[model samples]
Target: MNTNGLKVLLIDDTVMILQRLQSLLAEVKQVSRTESATSAEEALVLMDGYQPDVMVLDINMPGMGGIEMLRKLNVKQMIKPVVIMLTNNTFAGYRDECMRLGADYFLDKSRDFLMIPSIVEKVQERNVLQF
Candidate 1:
């Protein structure tokens, strides 16, 4: 199933990780728009203008973490974007908490990025309004 140009937002504190992920996502034809934010505030600001179909976010950061951002965005109840939690920490609690906070998937960045495609495919299959 093709996602057909789904908008994507990726938020991470690391500059290198953000760039690498953006490049990887860009390789997918269905990913038309891929935006990156180094902070939760920046991501939130971007969201105000562009409503993405799915968001791949980091769980840990300086000010507001992934869970905090997700919770806040959800409170608005405007766009229910599927969240794929990206984290270096693979602790059970972290995974459980992310799932509890409405993460569609959890990815460990310390490992190779093999599951991203599948995660995106799953999200597309589940929530793509045009699919």
Candidate 2:
């Protein structure tokens, strides 16, 4: 981890996915804090408080999917934290749309969960704070 005490917000609609991600990130020593949300609405509320440096989100949520949340976040002109999408949808169109909508990374849920740390690692290594 490039940052000594980085905080991350992990959001997903499923409890299982959230738990699995949390466990993967637990191995990294630099991540000092982790806040999670199961819905976009809940995540919005948490965002005002936690203000995480990085956000890993899942698209296709029940309500207020990842793209929707990004749209909402844009209105506030937030710091635009580095958002990595964890989704089952891997279509080229969806990935392109997410990038256009402010998502920095689009990853497959089935194969990318294990790479969370690596993604964060690269982001931290670049030292581009508040991406």
Candidate 3:
């Protein structure tokens, strides 16, 4: 994996949200690549071929939600990518649950939506330092 740039996987049911995230991350120099999945199930399948360094996930989705996906990822023991929980539901309970489930960061979609790229850049910086 490149320490200078991060491969980001975006999992959200909403196409517009995914597109916006992709567009936003595209402007960040630290983000080398971006992929999107309309649902957590699709993201899990995609992870087989594409190992992302970071994941921007939504808590609400059809079929399987982000919280369930996190549990599934843990069970798979796959690469533990930096998980960022982004959602419109910013309730304290949700934030606490996501963090407890191993989310590296939790951001309110309405307020922190614009902070994604900067957060990704920071995560890249940490990766560089770790390597």
Q: What TM-score goes with each of the models?
A: 0.87, 0.89, 0.94
On residues 63-113, what C-alpha lDDT tens digit does candidate 3 reach at each position?
999999998888885569999999999889988988888899999898989
lDDT of 3 at 37: 98
Residue pairs clashing, model 3: none
Report the poorest 10 consecutive residues by lDDT, candidate 1: 122-131
Best first by lDDT, ranked: 3, 2, 1
Model 2 clashing-pair count: 0
- On lDDT, the leading prediction is 3
The lDDT, on a scale of 0 to 1, for candidate 1 is 0.81
- Tens digits of per-residue lDDT for model 1 on 23-93? 78766766768888999989999987878888889989999998899788768757678888888888999
- Give the number of the best model, judged by TM-score: 3
- Please identify model 1 stretches exceeding 4 Å from their true place: 1-4, 125-131
lDDT of predicted model 2: 0.84
